[model samples]
Target: MASTETVKVKVEFGGGTELLLAPPQDKRHSLTLPRKDAAGTETNVTFLIEYIRKNLITEREELFVDGDSVRPGILVLINNSDWELEGEGDYVLQDGDEVVFISTLHGG
Candidate 1:
């Protein structure tokens, strides 16, 4: 396993939001994200973007907001295009690439 010291992640949310993530002090290329739902609860999920490869994220893997495992309500944008309309997990990520996640809701 690579040391968590070398991994870095950049996230961009809906409406041009963005954040830069640094690897945990003790690990390389490892990331843990926290989430709180409407009920005011928190959940921690661990994932490494460097591990996102052709095998792990096949063309069939579902695209969720922030690449999160728990919340699949939102959609991810690849190269400024929607994965659902273009291609889902089939969209491979390249180094120094840009991906965005946006919220989804039904309204009239």
Candidate 2:
């Protein structure tokens, strides 16, 4: 089994909302965010990429976008560059890297 490690993710919203979301206590490989628009909705984001391998070997890996049950609109960015525009699940994350998730807000 791979030794679990914790990664700090700073989640920010376009509407000036920010939070320091961490992985679950038991599994240091997943992140979950609550759905703001959907009442009582939750989303689970996981880190399946080989973080340690990438750090030791290559500096980049194809990024993947994944979440739990919720279907909220999310925009992932690294160093202010949009990951989707670059190619969904094709970006690389590094040590001490900053990953930001921006939630989409919908109104009547």
In candidate 2, what are the lDDT values of residues 1-108, reduced to their tens digit? 221233343433342112212212121223222222134322112331223222211321122222321124556566577765644444433334445555564456
**Which residue segments of model 1 deviate by more than 4 Å?**
1-9, 15-73, 106-108
TM-score of each: 0.36, 0.36
Model 2 residue pairs with clashes: 63-89, 63-91
Q: Judged by TM-score, which candidate is best?
A: 2
**Model 1, 70-107: lDDT tens per residue?**
14555666556766764455443333335555546434
Q: What lDDT does each candidate get?
A: 0.37, 0.35
By lDDT, who's the top model here? Answer: 1
Task: Please give the range of 10 consecutive residues that has the lowest summed lDDT in model 1.
Answer: 16-25
How much does candidate 2 score in TM-score?
Answer: 0.36
